[model samples]
Target: MLRVVRIAGPATLVGVGFAALLVALAIGGGAAPQLLEDPGAVVRFGLPTSTMLVNLAASGMIGALGLVLFAIPPASAAYGRALDVAAGSAAVFTVAAAFTGFFSYLSVTARALSFDDTFSQGLGQFLTQIALGQAWLQTTLIGAVVTVLCFAVRNQTALFFVGLLAVASLIPMAQQGHAAGTTGHDAAITALGLHLIFAAAWLGGLAVIALISRQIETPKLVDIVTRYSSVALICFIVVAASGYVSAELRIGSLDRLLTPYGLLVLVKVGALIALGVFGALHRRFVIKKLGDTGRRRHFWWLIVAELAFMGIASGFAAALARTATPVPETVPATQTAAEILTGSPLPPELTTANFLTQWNFDLIWILVCGFGIVFYLMGVLRLRRRGDRWPWYRTVLWIAGLLMLFYVTNGGLNVYEKYLFSMHMFGHMTLSMAVPLLLVPAGPVTLALRAIRKRDDGTRGMREWILLAVHSRAATVIANPIVAGVLFATSLVAFYYTPLFRWATEDHIGHEWMIVHFLIVGYLFVQALIGIDPVPYKLPYPFRLLLLLATMAFHAFFGLALMSGTGLLLADWFGATGRDWGVSAIEDQQAGGGIAWSIGEIPTFILALVVAIQWSRSDKKETKRRDRNADRTGEAELGEYNAMLEKLAARDGR
Candidate 1:
């Protein structure tokens, strides 16, 4: 029965996906022949089909690798087989990507196919120069690299990085989607990216399980399925959220639901709902019965059904990419200065009320904040249930910090940061200082270590990974007070003075990277000072105080320099925002400097107070230790000291 599932699952997935894609394309006019620049029926139809294959193959590669990294033991036969699956899938991804690229070029140019220098040159230029062509080229190349790495690398840690590379291969595809230049472009891109990544993880993981079920014992298979189910649950939530955002952007209104694009979206939504139900059944019913051989066949058959639904979702998703959106994704005819510079219209004037009330949510940070809070609470609850005492203050602080992070990322700061230098600085300061201040004291690492179970079955679990990271040499180096302080202090200059500032401002990916970089830097620095989590090395209280003071001084100096500067940072971006209201670009930059110097220093001062309190507590504890020792030892050390003093005095008298 398992063998039959192994064969039929993938066949069912491909067959169903192809069928759905054809039906969707037919209904949506996605594959219709162009009247003016028809690339022929072959290119018109083949592009979506090949792109669909690319999605399928990429999913298979990423899903298998994820299972291997997080669930399967490296030494197991299933691990190697999963890698083989990834490699094979990657190979297919490479070929399919290349074909999609070719079809895309033919469709765009509508040029006749010929074996001539001109045609070859045009193809070369397209792949190298054009953004769309470059995206496909990058995808194909990355797929090829992933394929080779899967075959060659066996170490679990190395494979994790390879998995990251595989996931990154989807970013270009996300960029090429319908929302690239539209309103809410960043939100759309983020949603689509998350959708692709999590959807692949969900669909491909089950396929891997089905293929490898017969190779493993029933007990182990049950464990693997349980783990995969957890991942699939996360995928389901993210896919649903991202799908809604994508649909909202593309359809624009509920009334448009009858359009071909929206109808395809509905089909995908139905498929997602069906897949979610299958996941629920597996967790609630089928997994427990897997121990009984009599019920094993039912599990495999259910997997077949789930794969069929996943196929429908995948196919509609691909077709929807090519389908025309109900709302046109075009810029306004009369672009404002804000729209010209930031690709968005000027928001209302920056007022105190608007500052607090406005919002522009980022899906990525929204998920991060949600997951961070939930997992931390889960860990805390687990500790409590085990009769361990976890601090309520820590939980409060953790939740508060994540909420602040969410606000900084998704609220008013995000809305105006693109148009105003001051707003960007304000958000940056909050991210690097205030949020980390709250989070570092929460001791998330310690909570995770205590809550997650230790695995000794030659498989690395969350506990093992956490311990490995904390004890690693890199952690030791970075956790050093001097190093963390230097990174925290000097990064401001390095980032703002270099092209990094411009990149982080203009590009969504770069913007996200900026947030992560500063947040981590601040976390490491604060953790080095007052964090409850264990570090490889720590300075004495006095030195910690000294380090904090020095770092903040340097930080203040950076702000002063910015204030005194006659020039503006990213002059083109901040200066060119054709706004008739608010401060001039240079004045705004100076105000940003003032914010960095003043508001940013508030958290540092809090750190100083905490360190001082810790110092006083340390002295009190030392005194108590000595008093106890004297009590236990009958004051023998004191008597000895007195006798030595008397002997020295007698010798001086003689």
Candidate 2:
């Protein structure tokens, strides 16, 4: 029994807990109130919502358990294998749980009875409800199976399968609340989902590493921890950003951040910061001092403590997910259609002339900023003589280009309005096209190095600081492929699916987040595609090409989905007004999605072709150099010529 407990403990505990919750909900007849018009019935049951809360809590607990189990070090080789099996089984169970809960919610809500009458429904209806909930439960189960299978396998090929399964599972889960109409609801849900996945990866990976540290020698432990630090930093950023977006959307007002949900979120954020601090300690002190006597146990304790807090935070997250969204009183029922189009409401006179006048001031400033950066960069380039090294000037030019790109993409117009397809198009181009192309060539790390080199190198203090910043673990992490890809992909997923898009159009705060997202995503995608700086782990050219192709295909599919969508997924925010742009709402939306699909391909294809050409050229040059070296005279008359050739080869490599 003790052995079984250790082998199947996490899965058994989570499964039994989830099953008990479901049984309790069914026995108490709590399913009916969710379908009611009044919210009071759910409150009466001490649940902020109906059985949805119970289901969500169960799912959260299962997810948390999976995370914990994944973190724990297997006691032995057999235990490790059993843990893998248990994880797979638990994932399968989760899928069933999701499906059943979904069906239950659907069946309970489909009944015509009010909130009071629904809870009073007979047992047969409840059981029928359980059948419908199978969809998501199955999906979750499949995802778990895939994750466990990934661990069981040792090949890179398995990663692709795991990635595919993960993406498949998230699709239905993300779409579940699509009908909620509230922009905040969509944003919060999407952000929360992303946060959960990222958290799982970070916490679970850390647990694995911690367990490994105990078993491996000090040197191997240091290497593993060092490698993982970069991943953790990226995850930290994702958690913070997503958490903030979710909190802002759910609270809907600055004042409500002090409320229960907000305070809880703050606590989670605090916990994350604490985790970061511990991570820093691991990097700065623990890992370096691993060879020291008696430090190994302390490191293990720190990791365990961090994992426990992460688990608690996950639970609080479950609670927070069920909390009532604070509705702001000052929000308008329907904003002026003109406001949606032009980004601001029309003047009191309400004439076309008045509308134009009101927006002119804002538009002029936007144009000034946009055009100013472009021309300034052009001027800087013109000033530099051909073949003269002006790395700093080039850096400034790229920075200027980025600023202008931001202005056009995010600053020029209202992103949330229905009819602002042109503005959205402009922003998308900057993010997916212009910015990536420009920044890729600029090479941020190389430029930073040049800038640091130009500083006072003679001063030991300043030089040390510069070296520290450039060679830091933080720098290395940002430059990792996995870290960069996750950040890039998550940004796109968060933007399209969440209320973040809608909220940005509704308020100033949302617009700022949009700008930040565009910049970060744009930077990551560019760095992935054509970075010149040192990346810790670089994918093979073929793999990079495949990743690029896959990303493009996904974007194109999303665009097609948007274009073909019968009902408005985002119509409320992006629809057009008659006075501006002259396009109908559906036409504008379809056009935007179509452009997103069609225009995206050009840059991708161009980049792929460029990479192929460069690779081929490099291969040819390498072959020629190898043949030349083979025929060279040994340490005689050709010494000077060989040195010259070596220098040229190095230049070519750069």
Candidate 3:
């Protein structure tokens, strides 16, 4: 079985992916019409084929880098081999992306090939000047950079950035796919982006491990395989989830499941389920007994089968990228300026009644908040099952935080935020301030540490990672009260006064990034103040109080700056919203400042009160400790002090 797998694994991967692509394309009509006037069969079929290679190569590069940085030790021979794999894969990615770009240009423009100066100039202009061409150009450049970095960089810790760059290189491809100029574009981008990341991790990991399996010592091989398996498991879950999302965006409804594109999706789904089962078998039987030669033999065969299935899934995905969806993504016409800017029609003017009803759901945040509530409940249940006590209020606070987060991101606030600066700021405050205030006290980290059983295996489990993160030097620095306080206050100015505000408002990626930044900054600040999660260290009560006061003062100053301002911050977006129902955008800006000042202070006060209570409790605890010491010794120290005083007096008399 081992010999068979060793020989057949890579071949099976390519073959299965190729077969799956061919099948899916035949079903979905991926072939463009072979017109007499158009570029010939080479160009026609070569485009999709190039795209499929690009995906495969990209997955290999990203997966290898991730495995190196996360699973394999830097000192191991396998680590260097993994880098070699990444370098090779990245080279392929770079080449394939460039070809895919050229093919894509040909597919779109339907021009004949030429190597003349005019052709060169036209190609340069297309790549350098156009958005669609630029996306591929950027991807190619990023791939090239990652390829070089993989070869040049050997430090394991620094390779994380390389992995990030590799993953990020896929974003442009996602953007260039069939999602643009559609209502589901955001969903498509998100789902596609996630799919690419997880899929790369899954596919690339197997390839790297298979390539380097012999070089790894038997002892380390087991550990590496176990870690990679963990990564694969997570990848499976995320891939499945993201696949569902992407399918929904493209397939639209279950009624269309019988359509060619939907059938392709079903095929991909089946492949994923098979991969999941393989992962489970590996985890249950093989990973636990890697030292057993017989078990290891079976594992290699299982890995080969898993690779084949992964290839099928990847092939289907590549074909699906080429396949046309049944529903038209294009809107008939958007007449309004807001529609032109935002891609959606201008919502009905904001009304009190609509605050409860209006919604522009962010699929990502909904999943996030939903998972948050689910996991927290799961932790609580785990604790209860083990006869452990967790504070009910902490659970309540966590639920409230997640619910509020969901509402802020997906409800009335999100609906109006694009057109209303005030609402955007309100959402920002809730995200960065109010939500953290609720969430920090929930002691999520503490709960996790207490609830998650420790893993003694060489693999770093979730609990280990959490502990490492908290105790890490980076955490220690960021968790510094001064640093957290400064960042919390300075970010508002930095964000609003720079291009960041514009980007956050204008782009979906930027918007999501903005939410994440706000939430993190808020959590850091609140954690510095009154977080129940154990940290590297804490400041004294007086310093904490001082820090809170200083933060509030800065907050007030920021509000005043906004309130006294005559110019609108985002005049272009909010100013031109064309709403007559609400107060003027400038007035709304001032009102946002007022809310930032007043409503913001309420949370500050709560923080201050909590800090004061903690201070009092600390003093009481100290007093009780001293009293207990006195009771234990019965004032022996006091008698010694009197005797010392008497001896001093006698010496003075003499």
lDDT at position 85, candidate 1: 94
Off-target runs (Cα >4 Å) in candidate 1 are 292-295, 635-654
Order of the predicted models by lDDT, top scorer first: 1, 3, 2
TM-score of each: 0.97, 0.51, 0.90
Better of 2 and 3 by TM-score: 3
* Candidate 3 Cα errors over 4 Å, as ranges: 34-37, 73-75, 216-225, 284-293, 331-334, 370-392, 447-468, 471-473, 635-654
Q: Ten consecutive residues with minimal summed lDDT in candidate 2?
A: 453-462
Against the correct fold, how does model 3 do in TM-score?
0.90
| Models ranked on TM-score | 1, 3, 2
lDDT of 2: 0.53
| lDDT per residue as tens, model 2, 280-361 | 8877887677746534666666666666566545545544534445654233578757644443453343334533333211
Give all candidates' CA lDDT scores: 0.91, 0.53, 0.85
Q: Once all C-alphas are superposed, what RMSD does model 3 give against the true structure? A: 3.2
Report the error of model 1 at residue 417, Å. 0.9
Instruction: List all candidate RMSDs to the true structure.
Output: 1.7, 14.1, 3.2
Query: Which segments of model 2 are wrong by more than 4 Å?
Result: 1-138, 141-153, 171-180, 185-190, 210-215, 328-409, 413-418, 424-433, 443-654
TM-score of 1: 0.97
Model 3 Cα shift for residue 53 (angstroms): 1.7
Best candidate, lDDT:
1
1 against 2, candidate with superior lDDT: 1
